[model samples]
Target: MKKLITALSVFAFLGFAGAAHAAEASGRIAMADPGTSTLTLEDGTTFEVVEGVPLDGLAPGTEVTVSYEEQDGKNVATSIAPAQ
Candidate 1:
């Protein structure tokens, strides 16, 4: 019973740790490349846009907020929207 509890606790902690890596960034678009499905901010932070996240109307100098997760040393964007 104790070993099972410990294993469950470890799995829960690992799951939360992965969730903790999700983050958001607000900045002006420095570059938006549909061919590569990537967006780069003015600060040089680049994010890889996941499939199904529309990039329409996004362009250089447009302010946007990016929701992303750090995966395998790259920022994988889950969503992007214009900044209010």
Candidate 2:
């Protein structure tokens, strides 16, 4: 039981370490809109503005920071918001 627990802990630690590195290597963008935001990343992009979340007050040329992640063999969004 003790050995198994130790192995699992190590695995978790390594996974977290890898994630930290991945985030650092990723690119970041910024947005000017406070109500709505959109960011373009590597192979994928994130957009918060839509029919539901309209960019009514958002100014043009607003940049959004986003990160990319692979999911089901497709690049997907990690996070997106006004580049702060």
Candidate 3:
């Protein structure tokens, strides 16, 4: 039963971990550097768009909402899109 308990604990931890990263709209992007795919938020925050992100129509000076996270103590943009 020890192994079962450990497996249950691991599964529960993983489930809660995903719930912790619940997509949230932190703020809006005000400036974008499509060359490097870096974005500047309205709150004066800058983000490094991860490689392979599809930023087709996203351009500089476009207002957008971002779902981000703090991973390894650094800002990580999970997803971003135009603000409603």
**Model 3 TM-score on a 0 to 1 scale:** 0.56
Roughly what TM-score does model 2 have, to 2 decimal places?
0.30
All candidates: CA RMSD in angstroms? 2.6, 7.2, 3.5
Model 1 segments more than 4 A misplaced: 1-20
* Regions of candidate 3 where Cα sits further than 4 Å from its true position: 1-23, 26-28
Per-residue alpha-carbon lDDT of model 2 for 15-67, expressed as tens digits?
87676321312343333343444434443444433234433444445554434
Candidate with maximal TM-score: 1
lDDT per residue as tens, model 1, 1-84: 999999999999999787747799999999988889999999999999999998877979999999999888899999999899
Model 2 has a clash total of: 6
Query: lDDT of candidate 1 vs native?
Result: 0.92
- Weakest lDDT window of 10 consecutive positions for candidate 2: 21-30
- Model 3 lDDT tens row, 1-84: 999999999999999788536345545556667687777777888776777666667766676777777666656676787778
